[model samples]
Target: MGKSDAFKALIIGGSVGGLAAAHELRSIGAEVAVYERSVGRTQARGAGIVMQPEVEALLANLGLSARSVSVELRERQQLHIRGKAERYRAPQLMTAWDALYRALREPLDDVCYRLDSSLRHVRVEGHDVTAEFPDGHVAQGNFLVGADGIGSATRRLLDATSRPAYAGYVAWRGLEPESAVPEDLLDLLSGRFTFFESSGMQMLCYLVPGANGELEEGSRRVNWVWYVNLAEHDLPRLLAGRSGRQFEHFLPPGELRPEIVEEVTEQADASLAPQFAELVRLSDVFMQPVFDLPPGRILANHAALVGDAAGTVRPHTASGTSKAFGDAAGLAAAMEGWTPRHGLPLRRLEEWEAQRLSHLVRVSEIGIELATRSSLGVPQGDKFFASD
Candidate 1:
């Protein structure tokens, strides 16, 4: 599709990937519409995400600058095992997911974003795709993009074989402002990345500067995530109490297990150095499931899968958002002059799939290996960050 083609494209899901696709399509002169299931102005859900260079590059290509999101770029990461420090230098970033989403949604003006319009089904013919919403509304477009998510309606309507498989672990994550945090912990964590490891669990912590480049009240906050292994039978108790009260671990703006919170606090108090322990003591905690989806490529007439919708890798690599944005870029490039009638060039789609599959496979393999090693109390050493 050339710039003068005037094609209409419909993107399902209004998150990062969907918004990026919408922006990319609009840049190419295609009329675009985004259907998101969420209602108006709900905060972006999820914990802090590490946006690497590639992700930053993609956002820049979409006309989104780093200043829009208060990106915190780090040059060094410190690893602590049994209370000793081991440091490695690498280029990484820490930022809230909601902030990144808002940044991406800022530059789009021509795109029509429809909230609460969840996709009900998709009918793809030889030269066009029709998307049906649950409210009996139908949208027709020259092409359709499924940026929905792990449980995508487009994926389900297209390929019923692909399913998300649980990776047998869950993550507890949260953020706390600097004022709420203690001074000693602030000194150790304010300027760099840090990780603490122990048997059967691990904690990753880093400083995300406030929106104004200062760590003041209601501005800068420390982002933390704790990965814990869960047995199958214990899932219910962890998910909800017997009284139907949801067991809160990592979802922000919710209650946390007092006992679990105190246990983690105590662990930091006794097992960590003074600076690191204070970071934990002064911080609030949250938790979430750490699940991975099956690995495979989805082949459709005029649609393709990207990011977690295709497959999910564990966050230990912190590469999900990066992969999604990268996938969007590739799809935009591949379909530059293609259409539903002729379909995206088989070779080009295959190439995109190959690139995404190779990266995601490596990430999943490393996640499994690390999970096993962490379970066995094996030393990860400095090589963990080296692979990136």
Candidate 2:
């Protein structure tokens, strides 16, 4: 049999990382299928991302045009603790999570992607991998990939020892249309990436396309994030839903309690500048408790972990998407270099393990530093600390 016909891959998760992995594996001549848990479309957080190089390369590989989907910011403005704004000449391509999702999803074949399917368990028989689904169906393949996000059931099965530990803070994210807010506010936020950092807290904002990927001037939306420290004991109170159940992951809009939301708004008004605080107060808000994942190898059995399922660097690194792209690229390269009987996935996995471990260390460190940057510190010497 030809290499193309020799193996099949079953992928868990259909977000960006999973989709990218599907595309890359298919290109390397493996039969590929993706399994996602949601019945409807993915409800992304609508947050903005600084498109790192790895993501750009993935887009180029698919021959997709990003101009219609992304916004290019020519400079960065940091609101210093001294009550002054400093503009840096760092340019970046920024896009919403939903926009990037659609751009990447459009190019993938619909036939191979499965929604409303979740992994219940996996059975490995020598080199063969079979995934058991909650719906009582089974899919067997030569390779299996777990691209599920941080709450990954795959990570639970493969690497049970590593749990997502709270990182002492949470990110409050919001997005609003340009027309929905005041004109002066839009002018202040448009055309540049802006950040406000104070006593270990940070607020960052940028512009991105509107709902359904609309990218016109006034049609676009503004995306912002506020990173605030919350004591560990108080997290459950904020995560309490309408049903009163405390959640550890993300909280949907309806589940957000009125009292907690009101309290957060009051805190914003008190702590943030009036203009910036108004921006947070006026917009819809949600919470994501930050977590730290120390780096590790993703390969195990004939199955591998792809994207966030593998490891998650803090959002401060801005390398979350880029790291996922690199994982997909590295897997494709290893598969392409395969030689029947002579192929040693173990050796290849070892090489990838070392490379990604080192990569995540550098990335996570930079993220920690940025998240904790203080005005009391030395002048920003190396801009590398601010890179993706």
Candidate 3:
């Protein structure tokens, strides 16, 4: 690698973290390309995300307006089963994953993003890296980033031993359009973050931008997530899709077996607060088992891992998106002032890894503590990802 060589970055995983990295690196004049495994845009994945400064910075850097895609939130309330509510002032911004995705990707041309490009192999030669795809396509760049997420193939190249550990619980999630929400339900859920906590179960709901990032009153969505405790042995059964094949990550909409849906519906009606029970009953739902990945090395040769690829902190931390953006910002900053380098800047990469790994360790601990405190069935020694 010569000082005059343009910094060409190959980013794996086209989700929030990877796209954020592309924008940040591009702002620094780096040529970047992103590869996503999904054949089409992931319009339905992910739910509500609490606004963080890092997200705002990423959007602004990309020349996109965050407010155009976000909703202002004013308070947090605990909704009791008896319909009583406990409220507190907690101002924040909330956005949907799809809205942010559309905003970040709006500026990038198709040439820079490859859909359906699943990574099969990665080869590192000095400061240069090459990514091989299953369809016989190969991409080479000055550097490689494993922003592909928790199951990142690039992370395997860095440290194969680390994997996402199950958190002994699964989150049942749904989104209901404001237009479709009953006026009473909207009255209770609109403009505020509401929670319902009980023994081994927790539910929360908030408003997020609606279709095509619409922020109007009638176009917004009521996003809810219900975390339910599940014994480890019962996880596979719940993760099994309609095809009878078990999924390791999540059960997307319409994938849950009919019986499973019935069981959850019954549980919601019996155990959840009246408002939440109605919300769950009225909307189609999906399930994602919570998982935590203990911090580990995030770099291998010239390749670096970011976002969930580095470590997956439980959702209670509310730091997943922030952590992804933080990782992107840190990496971009590390590579910012480097003049033409002869080889990979091993020391700088190490510094970024140290900072990020430290942050991940702290966040992971917080998630565990919060989940345990919530009585979500997380037992001692059950914090690591189990490899089948």
Candidate 4:
């Protein structure tokens, strides 16, 4: 392929990482197209997502500036011991995952995003890559990026041996309207993110501006996530009874076991102070299983993986989005000024892979440690949030 030839870049997935990659590639003049399995305009599928400064920087780089996004910039994060109401603060931001995705998607005008097109297979030969879809459609690109997430089809095509391993826990998340919560609790949760921990279970709560960017009265919403230890065998059964529509992404509201729900409610009622109780009682709960994807490198001709497709860390550090953004930026930077025949700059891919894997390993370690330590009522050190 000639240098002047418009390079066709096919991005498999339209989530945060995939959309960011497409935008970055397009900004640099690549002919970009995204294939998302879900049909229709994407909305907040899961509960909430925390967008750290590093992740925000990538969004700004891709022209999806933070100013236009409706997210609660959490200047501080707090940790609350299970039986104690006292909390300590750390820095972060809280926002809905769907809101973030929509913010990124809105800025792209030239890119073609095809929804309902699930990837069936990727045929890679030399520098040419052909992505086949389940609908009997095929797209050929000079390069292919597998940003399809944890259960990535692109990863499957590139490295069939890769699979997600469970971390022996599940995370339940949900959003509650602020008005439903009492005044005192809203005051405590409104300004900062809060975390609560206990043996075998952990819960977090934070305020996010409502869909309209208002946290006042009935307009604001509070986001909550609960992580609980679960035996691997019981996961499918726990998730099975929910309606198929509700089970599409994370667990839907009010689907967890009544006993577990009652236990959590009772715990929050007893342990959390009046300020924290309102946030918990007003919470519209949802649950999800947490898993850790071990780090591994994928080296092949004309193909690559990024974000959760490459590996995943637990959400404790709130670094998943940042890691995905870093991967997108690094991969885009690696592909600069390259032709199809020349293939991906091997040295560049190597450097990008090394940097990404190192960061992921550190983040994963922190996540595992936090999962164990938070349960012990230990205060998280500030060093965990420092950049490598």
Candidate 5:
């Protein structure tokens, strides 16, 4: 491709991040293609997500909106064992990972979306970059984006030394069907983002759309997360499911190891409030180890990284999706600035990198601070997102 050729942006990974990238690039009149490793639908267990403005803005920009797939929340509460509680009332939007994915992925044309296509590597030669597939299919584009998430192959190829480190805590997460939620407990969790915290541990639950994206009362699901400090050495055994197969990614339901479940149950019973313990006992749970990825070397050799592939944020900041949305917006702006007058637009790319890295640093720093504050019985504070 010549310097004056039409812009062709190849996006790796077709999840929320990559699809968002495609949407932004297409808006700028760039040729876009998304290569996703997963063949069909993809979902994460314990997938309740708190939506942010940036994500909502992107959806608006793409002329797409979440449909029948989210529950609007009105308050945040911290319940005490003595039955007293403190409430922080604010309008919040929560949805499932599946809902967010559907809202973002359904808009793109299928012809340019290559499912079951995994990016094995990328070779940058002169003004163009070539993406190699495992099946030997090669795609050439003017620039490349790595949005394949935390275990990103593009990140590996782009910065060979990047590694995701364990964050010293594991979140035991699950969803309780409104049907399964106890008659008494339903009222407490239904309309609010509720949390219960103890020294070195915290538990929170709030209502979200049901599996079918139902929003009616008694049909919505209550999503819960319990954070505990689990040593890194024990992770290997925990990764093995009842089938004895140690999966690399987060374990899906039924595949969670019985021992880990038992451990969580015991911990909940011993350390958690009675109602919370029962919630833990009845719900099928999944585990995710937290990690802090310092922003480093995201832009290099005609490519950039987005979303978790860029760097993951601890959920405490409630900025994971926002960060991804910001990356997509930044990339769109950078590409649009690449005119003949500016040539390669290297300065825009660098400015984009600086802005994104600063945001990641702020979120990650708050996440680390949250660990210290969890012992104080509040995982996050009002000034949380405001500080950065």
Candidate 6:
């Protein structure tokens, strides 16, 4: 819609995608309200994003400098199990999830964001849409945007058939303070992307802006992710947190069962390089079960899906964050051409869905291929070697 249009947007899930849609839509003159299920600030419970141009664009559009929250690396190195290392010149920017989330959220007005508000139902009547919350509050808008993450309630409400399929592996991730890292390990990992790979597993680490977006030498953090293959039956035990609660997606740091944590430590000591083993031992690690959700129809009448709500490609693509922001941009671009005078942007949404679905499919295929090549045991063919 144009700047002169009277557009009201109701957004579900106030995380990156939701907040991004808020920014993009607002720039085009839409009044936006974001509803988040979390009562307090939402933690991504993950770390380390390879900066993408689209992500940087979103930050730039918000008047934030990417350099303020990112660290630049000059090379990629692979540390072998036997201590031999292979290196390549590859420059990239890395940032922490907390840093990006904080930058995006800080500028959003408190009145436009609602916390402790879980979506109860979505009602669409003619050209208008309404979002009902558990508290019996209803919000009406010209359109509804679903920017929820992988286990999206909005996706369920729109297309019950689309669901996240467990990818038969889990990522053990952690962030260690630079000040706490051993001097030798710190010097070894400081300005390069380091990785180690073995049968059915891969581990990588890089520097990221630390607590509260601090980028100073001693204040930064080393972000690492280890993707390990596991049997489907073992998932239940691994996902069972210390409180005896079974988590569907991930266990926050310190929530992992003590025994599970011990097992992972032992595995690292036994199989990983000495440096990586020590890194794992020193950090408070967390676990995230990987899953892939293929794109279904992302638009239903005046309601639409963005980010993981539409599709979830594997993390191997390193495009999750970029994809989320891209969805918001794509949606905004589509809507920019239409106004309320033309009624609902059904045709416009269809065009956006077509373009987005094609991109999601391509990225998902690339992730599957990368997973197989990295020995994660995925059976996909070498359809492509590109990324989003």
Cα lDDT computed for each candidate against the true fold: 0.67, 0.77, 0.83, 0.70, 0.78, 0.85
Q: What is the full ranking by TM-score, best candidate first? A: 6, 3, 2, 5, 4, 1
- Which stretches of model 2 miss by more than 4 angstroms? 1-6, 80-84, 243-245, 337-344, 374-388
Please give, for residues 136-193, the per-residue lDDT of candidate 3 as tens digits: 9999887888888877878876776877877778899998788999998898888799
CA error at residue 134 for candidate 1, angstroms: 1.9
Residues 16-128, model 4: lDDT tens digits: 88887887776566778898877876434356677677667866776665544544544454555443455455655566676677667777755788999789987877778
Roughly what TM-score does model 3 have, to 2 decimal places? 0.94
Model 5: CA > 4 A from native:
1-5, 64-69, 82-84, 337-342, 375-388
Clashes of each: 10, 0, 2, 7, 0, 1
Candidates sorted on lDDT, descending = 6, 3, 5, 2, 4, 1
151-256 per-residue lDDT for model 6 (tens digits): 8888888887888988877899989899999999998899999999877788999999988899889999999999988766777777888887889887889887
Find the candidate with the highest lDDT and give its number: 6
- Candidate achieving higher TM-score, 1 or 5: 5
lDDT of 6 at 60: 90
Which run of 10 residues does model 3 get worst, by summed lDDT? 379-388
Better of 2 and 4 by TM-score: 2
Q: How do the residues 303-373 of candidate 1 rate in per-residue lDDT, one tens digit apiece?
A: 77777777777677777777778777777776666644454577987887788788788887886787777
How well does candidate 4 match the true structure in TM-score terms? 0.84
- Please give the distance, in angstroms, between residue 74's alpha carbon in candidate 2 and its true position after superposition: 2.0
Deviation from native of the Cα of residue 329 in model 4, angstroms:
0.2
Over the full model, what C-alpha lDDT does candidate 2 score relative to the true structure? 0.77
